[model samples]
Target: MTSRALDELPSRNPTGAFRATDRADPYWGGMFATGISDGWVSASQHRRATPEQKRWSGVPASFVTDPADALAQMRTNRHRPSILGALGAVASWRTITREQLAAITGSAVMARTYPKSLSAPFSAGLLAHGHVSAGMNRLAPARDRMSMWAVGDQIDAYARYRKSLTFAEHVAVTGGQGWDAEHRFDRHNVLTTELALRVAEYCDVATVLGEKQMALPALLAAAGIEAAQADLGRKPDAGIVRRDGLVIAVETTASVGRGFRGKVAKWAQILQRHPTYELPLVVLVVDASTPSQATSAAAKNTTTAEIQAAIREAVRDYPGTALNRTADRIGMVPWPTWFPAPHEATAGFLDLTASFLARGHGRDEGWRQMRLLDPGEMPYREGTTAAGETIATNARLLAATPHWLRTGTVPRTDQYLVDQASASDIEVLSSPRVPDRMTGPGFTQSVAGRKWRHMIRLDRTHRESAA
Candidate 1:
């Protein structure tokens, strides 16, 4: 970030390294530097190049090795208004001159996301991240946002994502076929690797995120590490091989749903049996939007604390109420992205990781088993908000509402919402309709399965004609 440091970075990528970074990218601001010997290189925002950036940013890439230095750099560089504003503009799918961001400061999150962009051509992926209802009031942390941008790798993923729009109706995406059908987190490879960099800071462990794809066991053996399971299958977010030769599996999730509870319980049983098999899970539920009347000062603490309580309530029944003894191995270290102190709050990731490593190895039989990540140490990557991002989604029909008076049968869904231009209001009515769409509220029970996009009448009128 200083003059001499900039002088040390290569001005040109002589390797023609196939590295990629563009300020125009929407998610994962830029590619994580993999196998790069140097640190990060800033992206150019202007259509034209600046003489200063040309000399400084040499497409810098790095697999973060040192936690303290990497996090501090992220915290310090977060103040660089030029990049911060550029990312906001990119997410909103707008273009602004670097000069505009130069004066930006204070709560750095943009007010609106893809909803306003929902109609925009650029939001084809629908990048509905974090809070869905936050139209013009969405807030993002600078450290988390900027750090994520530094790991941008969205181009190839965009190509495949564009094709998902053409998916046919009535398609059945059983198994994992439907999960990767759309572009969820295109930069997840870089995102996970950045997380490992932070983990490497506290303990001696090799991460699976940044390693080049090779035979799994071969890679682990080469690194002198071992996995508790034969397949360290891409299930866990990140894991490390500690110096003491123990494998600590790390998982972070935005959803505290039943699925998450089951995952925690699986690891809980694993740790309970193995005892020293420490798994630190970081659960960050993005706080709700500020109250319409709440001032910025009040919204900061209140919203985050409320979210924290919601997490506690969700975790209350983990593994079940009867299994309190089994649940003690699983703990929570809450990292609230509390208000103006976003940067400091995120640094908690490092604090939590250090605490776990220092006290683990079958030690604190009862201390908060899974230490919630400190937000500060979270600089290696962004704290996830939502588990899913709609790069491509099953469509919702825009057809006019059927006249129940004439049709005599309502569609077969549990409920349906109709908005009529002639009516003064719109109403979401509960109905006997069935399986309207694959990606909406009724997905779980819709036996028609994923990619099905129509609701039909439950009446025998259509059934008799089949004969």
Candidate 2:
């Protein structure tokens, strides 16, 4: 592979870190500003203040003050706990020094934790009302390390919280759950909207490269106006109209999985009817990681290379034959494939979104569909036959391993059965005579069913039997 220096490639701003200048009030902000003070006071009082708190409330009063001196004094004091407690008491007093307050606020803003804290009240309010949805509330930890939040789990929590609170109470707490929910949805929408705008913004460039025709500069001018409008929270009026007379529909999503698969299939059908215009459909996958990497030149180049490769492959292997045909009909040619060195694929979605938005279609709905794509049917329940067989084979191999022999291992106990059984009844067998865990057929078969339950039972049972 020919390696290029990081500085060699043309640098484009991959991070859509452009702050939207439109100053319309954010729903969450309004919700928080109105509700946080009261909620904070209530939550604070509920946790009764102690004598130590009283003492800590007023001493070394400012956060900006040199705490080093106070810290040293505490350390030197024979009664360190008493001194420290007194300092804390002084600090906790509601009359925080202006300097201390400023320091605390500045730190909170930098950490992004301040927003989270402020949102708690609003979140409480939403829980009071019943407007939150189940899926939104079920945010769980992400299976992939790349994601920050278990979006499903967070959604679930938010939903549960909303269910318990009234709208007014929610507003009192933070703006309520509805506001928070809207914020989440709106962020996703804005991202998708930006993607469409990006596509529209770059239409002329694509037209030049793909069609080998000079598109009117006016198209560029229109795209710029739309981009500005999108930044202002105004949805731009744009649609995909191909030369072949087909009006391409746009969908925005935070996730792209099974839900989108159906949408894509439907779009394919629609494109079939408009044989004149090749359906020009675009999918903009918005990634939040681009800005993080874009700050460093080396990281940026590596990211760019990976993005280019992925996009090339995606376009080349685009599943829709109709879409490919449309690209050909429009005299569009794919851009030259020049991969940047030290490729990283995480930013592919961002790069693609920027490229498309720069072309001209800036206004569209953003949709988030979360699911993993499996080439074959998922091996859950009815689909488990083959997977079960594989597990069984592996389990037998594991049974013959020395670990199983030494441990006296048993395999394949169902979860429901284990759940019904007493903890003492379960046993784990670890015998030298048994094969390695992976080699045993029973071990593999157990894994096919309730693997954890089976293991736990086997372990407990073995220890009991040995005793």
Best by TM-score: 1
Give candidate 1 regions above 4 Å deviation.
1-183, 186-193, 198-234, 240-242, 277-329, 334-349, 353-467
TM-score of 1: 0.29
For this target, which candidate reaches the highest lDDT against the unseen true structure? 1
Error of 1 at 139 (Å): 16
* TM-score (all chains, Cα) for each model: 0.29, 0.23
lDDT of 1 by residue, 1-467 (tens): 01121113232211221111111121122221221112222221211346675443322123212333322332332322222222322221112111111111111132222112111111222121221112221233322222222212222333343343211111221111221222133233233333333233232222222121222343344345465574364245433432223233444432245665555545444334332222222222222232231235665455434433333443343332231233333333322322111112133343333222112336423233232333332221321321111100111110100001011221222222222222112221222233322221112233222333454433345434422
lDDT of 2 at 107: 22
Worst 10 residues of 1 by lDDT: 397-406
lDDT of 1: 0.27
Residue 6 CA displacement from its true place in model 1, Å: 17
